[model samples]
Target: MLTRFVHSGPVRLWTQHLGHPTDPTILLVMGTATQGIGWPDELMRTLADNGRHVIRFDHRDTGRSDTVDFTTHPYTLADMAADTTAVLDGHAIPAAHIAGISLGATIGQWLAVHHAARVHTLTTIAASPMGNNPGPAWTRALTGQPAAPDELPPPTARFLNHLTASAQTPRTTHQQRIDADVQTWRVLNGDTLPFDEPAARQFVEHSYTRATDLTAATNHDRAGRHWDDNRRAPLSAITAPTLVLHGSADPLFPQHTAKPWQHRSRQPD
Candidate 1:
């Protein structure tokens, strides 16, 4: 795998690519505040082994990408979609299989609708057709109302702490950071899958070290709140083969959340 930075508009994106250039491409777009490194390396390698080019990148406000405060000048889902296009443009990839999770999936939706020619296939995981439910927590956050404990922020202090501890020069507050990573994954873990604390910690730590800006997650949430509106074009506009994958026990996005896409895409659950 190679790690590099690609200029994408005002912000440069941190990218990782695996597999041969000749292989079919798989472009992975992660959810809001989700680090590209957090994506399973095994998955990338497996796809590469099967003769697929796997590409993943950190969004503007995540990982080694440039961090800009979005509070003063908010960006839309369309802007995010363009960022993906910029990424593809940066790599000179004509077209690729596009897959995203949650917020990233929503961006994928935009790409499929507005930038159809660039997408070979569309796959959304743990996402709603309209992006996400937002629910009570995110709703409150957007409205400037006091958020409940669960809805504090996507990239919580604990998550940052864990990232800090995962650095090459491990901090003295290592235990606390490790604990944060353990708890964070525990909360997001689906019912069918056991929480792998050790693995989770390692992944978070590695990503943290590689990240150029630890506060990118916080900035990502700002843009996320601005575009949290449940918006989507008619499913008929989507021409590529589409796949919607949602975990039955996903705490953030329940099965009902994925129902719209399944119903509209005419794909069986």
Candidate 2:
């Protein structure tokens, strides 16, 4: 694996490359606030071992990449899409298959919508239509809407811990930080998969040592507000073969959110 900085216009991105240049490329896009290194090595190597070149890079405000203050018109989802292309340009790759998770999925969908030629295939994991689909009641509650009488209140304690973890300063001892990370991941783990405490702890420690940015998640969420006007991009516009993957037990985004995308991306008769 090679780790280095790749420039996309004025933005310098921290990137990691695995596998040979001759192999087909797979660009992995991570969701809001998370650094590219957060991607598991096993997953990247598994794909690379099967003759694929895997690339993962830190977004502008995260990890070792350039930082942005969310106050100014900062960046937006569209800018992030362009960042993906810039990464490809930096690597001299004309085009490649893309797989995205959470906010990354939103970026991939927009890339396919507006830059169809640049995408060979797209896989969106654990995300929903951009802005408004009347998500679940939990989503509504989180967004400050009045919860339906029957709807359950948002899980504040659990969610707040995640925010607390993201905003944790590196000033704390490494072990304490890793322990906080473990707790956060424990809360977010899906029911279908057993939590791997040791692995999660190791990953948290590795990412901490690599880079730390307390404001990444908040800045990322701010940047994503660019889609506020047209939250839901037109999925039918995407011509590439697309796959929507969501866990049935995903707490952040319900599995049903994937249906509209699956329905919209179908080929015309």
**RMSD (Cα, Å) of model 1:** 6.9
Question: Which ten-residue region of model 2 has the weakest summed lDDT?
Answer: 260-269
As for candidate 1, its clashing pairs are: none
lDDT of 2 by residue, 1-269 (tens): 99867887777898899999889999999988788977888989999999999999998887888876667648788888888999998898888999999889988888888888889999999777654333365566655676554333344445644655567646377677677768777877855789998988877777676665755656877676554543465677789999999876775654433345444332222
Q: What is the C-alpha lDDT of each candidate?
A: 0.72, 0.76
Best by TM-score: 2
- What is the Å distance of residue 94 in model 1 from its true position? 1.4
Clashing pairs in 2: 131-231
lDDT of 1 by residue, 1-269 (tens): 98767886777888889998778899999987778776788999999999999999988877788777776656767777888988888777989999999888888887887788999999998776654335564455444566443221222334334434555443358566556656667766744788887888887778677667666576665665554332435556789999989776666654433334444332222
